[model samples]
Target: MEDNYLTMDLLRFTTAGSVDDGKSTLIGRLLYDSKSIFEDQMEAIEKASKQKGEENVNLALLTDGLRAEREQGITIDVAYRYFATPKRKFIIADTPGHIEYTRNMVTGASTANLAIILVDARNGIVEQTRRHSFIASLLGIDHIVYCVNKMDLVNYSQQTFSSIKEELKTFSSKLRTKDISFIPISALKGDNVVNRGKNMEWYEGSTLLHTLENIHIASDRNLIDCRFPVQYVIRPQNDKFHDYRGYAGRIEGGVFKKGDQVMVLPSGFSSKIKSIDTFNGEIEEAYSPMSVALTLEDDIDISRGDMIVRKNNSPSPEQNIDVMLCWLSTTPLQPGGKYAIKHTSKDARCMIKNILYKVDINTLHRIEEDKKIEANDIARVSLRITQPLFIDSYSSNKATGSIIIIDEATNNTVGAGMII
Candidate 1:
């Protein structure tokens, strides 16, 4: 049972929508119906609900743990929750919906495999819906489930659901995400959330829980381009292991096997994988997201920030690159400003060579006239790095294609960028 639990695949997903679209409530419903909540948690929620003068338990309380959020009845910061069913484990990032909290949503959804965008049935497709959907696409979330929430308010009307679904389809057609789905649900009334309630008999879609448990995410990882960025160097000089030299890191893409021909970047040294050692023991093979120490056949000087890739298939070395940058700082982005850049395991300095254009996320248009980038603003910009980086396009490999810019004086992460 322990082994089964350890081996079970985990899914990371984020919930996004406008204010009061029921993102938190939907997550609460999942945790409750799945029996993942403890008795103490339930009792606390019940007590809090009573204090708030609610007739029924406020499911949103399960995730809205902040005092300010609870007092104001709005989620300001990202709230993360964990739960598991027999089918799979889940990490839920309940992100804020306000436009000011756009950076919070980006931070929560950065590492997610899927996104659930809640749409109020009464309003149909709104501005926030389009904003969240576009951000999800920008973050390379291939799977998107647009939950048509608050179905009970619309009397669970099939016509309303159909119309909203059509509108969503038309809007999402412009997005790069290929896999899109729609589900009608009422987080408050628990209709078609965990169980298919009788309120929507005309709807023949799977419940939200069922869809989450069975979404096809196995092929979502990049398996063709092999990339392993060395994070640390392990060398035990003890009596038994006097000559041990290993490069320890997490694989970013593709599969690596013993005896595979690999090359170290920057230095461009060639070596074969001698062994792949994990915490358990030596493994014959390792793949993306796996942390392992790799021993090379030859003695080579490799250290942190060096990438090991298939000898024939390697990321191109780039010194200047174009990126879609999301400015996360209060100070507006300054053209020709130099900042510290961190990408994968590598670190370097980068300068803002040019500010190409700012994106009007709601309209999906490029605003070339406006060069000033403020907080929560997404823009296309050119960067000139101090060192050549082994990189792939963000669309191809997320792990190796994303970068963060840190303010030199403040040492704060000011921007997040995706390689174009």
Candidate 2:
């Protein structure tokens, strides 16, 4: 029998909230109620809960894997957990909620299809909630869920959930995000997390798990603009059938198939697709997010960082690009600062030419007077690169429109930017 896991769809989502908002507990509850937790893991959590003198098992311990995290009672780093259900496989990124960890939330939300913003019913909405929601929208997440957690603390009041939901709707309107939903739950009590408990009788909606499995994410990918960034040039020196050369990389956008005429960037070389090679065999067609090695009918001087696209539909090349940058380092971003820019597989040097404005994440206002960008600051800036980059607007195609900045001296990623 064929394994069902092979065909199951995968979903990547992140959980963001303030400290002690039950982000970890909600993830733990999902794992526990869905029967994804192992016997040994459950035993350890049970023992730990008893050691801490808790009446109920501390489900947060399941995601707080680090010893320091458990000791401090906070999430200091991004913790990723994997679990599978009958319908879908899920990868959960439990991001830290503190203001200092804003960069971590950006990193976690970068690749997520949906974001769950947990709000404490007792506290209503706070600054951290707005901060995370803004960052999630800025990262281009399509779906957002306002999970009103700890409902038991507020007596499972419908008024509390309704009020919080309305506040969230009003706040999110200023951002680019559109799809938002509300769910009331008590993560500690496992109410309406994975299973619908009897506590909330007024709330009518699918459980969190059901919503996750049913959300239509297949349309999230860009299937119109063909973009293939060649990462490697493959050659076989062996004499078995020695004349084999292939360009290997992931398809970032659109569809690519054998015999399709494609053009290479910068070089303006044109070639027809010969075959799509895989470990198993040659594939007939490939689309966005598929990794394959393509052999061209005509061999041209193609190397890493060269992009392939349809001749009629190509990305614009620019040497001076405007971008919205999220500073990730402790050092403030200075104008004229030089850094290493990595866009797709292309790497080059760039200098910050101008700082247009800094965004006050709380208010979504552009602060033009204070152009200095500090750690976890988001700003719109202009950059001049040594070479031209083939790119698109982030709204058009995320895979081809994003860039990361690396500190030249420290060799660390200091910023992430999206082309405007």
Candidate 3:
């Protein structure tokens, strides 16, 4: 089983590819090969396989659970599956591959640490490949695993793999990608996915499982910028601790320690960290992703949505900001529409100030003529918020650097923006 139950470790991974590139199959194979599936689940797939008259069991059947999905043999929604090996526990987001479902890919990849871009060996690279990589980079995902799937169909040729690798290198160079690695594997024949394949003797790298288990993801967060937006206030009215007041929140950035000075955002009032409180008792320091109730030396009327950050390295407070937005609504984005702007935990009413230009993601050219940006389209736009937002560049900090737009009428997320 995954060490999560034992150690509370979790890895969130998302799969991306063109339709029929075998993203679902790859996830099923990983789960099956890792012995993460239960016997009852295996039996059900085996029975389903016999009914379908397939030569071999469709491993993808394990995850394609919807009746409409199984009938059509297509992944429509973002199917989240959880499985674990002794070394690690994984939450896999099997994202839809259709171009129309670009929003689904964005939703799945929002919290992912690594993205597995599956590419068919026969097709090589395509526009969807570029789009997927662009979205990964935009979302601040550091690691990219280019799994060249269906290697058995290519006769396990190194030439084909090398050609794809070179093309990926050339294409990825134009993108703002940080870490990229290529691996050849046949998800169908199970080569180099969980075990080394004898057919591909020239390749020398650990299997995909090894890569997932050992990737250096510990230092991915920006440790220099300390951002703690209080989510809730804990006050227990008991006899023992009647006067206890704590600020409950998740650490969004850098290390926080006792006696370190922190400034509440927009207020500019400085205070010292009295102590860091956790269920396990008091701690001296904390970092990003850790949930703790912080006790400050002074009670400065702090509440939810209020940010506690380092006084020296604070973000610029501004109302007007430039952003790269990926439209997610069917209604085309109007240049001057009012919407609910959510930055970190703080909410504000914002009006679209200007529409700069929409970029053709397939070709990376700005389409000046196309002013109307529809669903799945990326564009550069400016916003004028009613309240000032404290943020850093999206390229530097994902937490403080990103915002999601929700429509006032329907209350749906209409777009995602990256602060520039």
Candidate 4:
């Protein structure tokens, strides 16, 4: 039992689709059927359902937490929920489905291991479906599950499911997804959600809960290139360990072991890893996403935003970058606009060199003539930074390849870009 507990991994996934596609309901059903919700929460939902004159308890209300969202019956911001099964722990990012909130969807999916693009069976394929699918592909989501929701509304017709599946396949051929699966589900009726519903007699695939528990996500992490961005310098003031000096940060890629030779970026200083220290004790090795302090064999000047990486396989440091920019601010992104660029632990000023093209999400067309980018618009742009940043392509490593643009005066994150 202890070994099984130790080995159970966590899966992070995001849901995206058009408005009223049952994205929230699917998540609520999963939580309710898995017994992850509290008794008081269930009673509260029942009370809300009564107030709304609902004959049955509304599961969708479970994730629509904000009063505005519950009153409006729409998800305006991203809702996150956590639960655990015997096989795996899960994190769900329930994103808004409206076209206007495309930037919210991108923020939720940035760290997801997989994406679930929901579609209403009655609606078949719509424009929003294409838009969300394109965003998923652009974000480098390798695994996609097209859940044809509201199967009950369509009378659980296999013919309808088949037709929608075919249409999605034809549309998604233009994407760069590696794997896509189709599952017909009725989020309201609990069909193929946590348990298989009797209405779908022809479907032979595993339930959604089972797939979430069993999907392989171990290969999602980049474990070949070592990149550790130092976030803090640890120096215990006065103690028996007075000479102790360590660099603390979360490892973004590859495996780092004790005694391994490493180099500090910007300074080009080399040293050997003396120890990997964690809260409990010293660890033999550490990998991506693990937060630990590392002591070096030699005393070196390393500060925040400085990266420690393997000498042979190091990230390229460059000042000019080509990126796919997702504009999130109301202010239009124009050529020569200046903003603060935040990449990992580094902060630098950058000027927009050029706007290559704005993409039409529905058709995936590059509108080269549109040099101005407004809210929720995605475009390819070039940027010139004041300092060289050690980076990689977003496809090569998401942790080191992404950046956020902040308005200098207001200090608001106005844009997110994936380095190309």
Best by lDDT: 1
What digit string (tens of lDDT, one per residue) describes model 1 on residues 123-167? 999888889999999999989999999999998899999999999
Model 1: pairs clashing at backbone N, Cα or C within 3 Å = none
lDDT of all predictions: 0.92, 0.90, 0.87, 0.90
CA lDDT, candidate 3, residue 162: 98
Stretches of candidate 4 exceeding 4 Å from the true structure: 1-6, 69-76
Question: After superposing candidate 3, which stretches have Cα over 4 Å from the reference?
Answer: 1-8, 67-76
Count of backbone clashes, every candidate in sequence: 0, 0, 0, 0
* Colliding residue pairs in candidate 3: none
Q: Write the per-residue lDDT of candidate 4 for residues 307-336, one digit (tens) a residue.
A: 999988899999999999999888787579
Q: Let me know the TM-score candidate 1 reaches against the reference structure.
A: 0.97
lDDT of 3 by residue, 101-123 (tens): 67778778888999999999999
Give lDDT tens digits, candidate 2, residues 280-328: 9998889989999999898788899999999899999999999999998
- Identify the runs in model 1 with alpha carbons over 4 angstroms from their true place: 1-3, 69-76
Which candidate, 1 or 3, would have the higher lDDT against the true structure? Answer: 1
Lowest-scoring 10 consecutive residues by lDDT in candidate 4?
A: 67-76
lDDT of 2: 0.90
Q: Pick the candidate with the highest TM-score.
A: 1
Ten contiguous residues minimizing lDDT sum, candidate 3: 67-76
lDDT of 1 at 249: 96
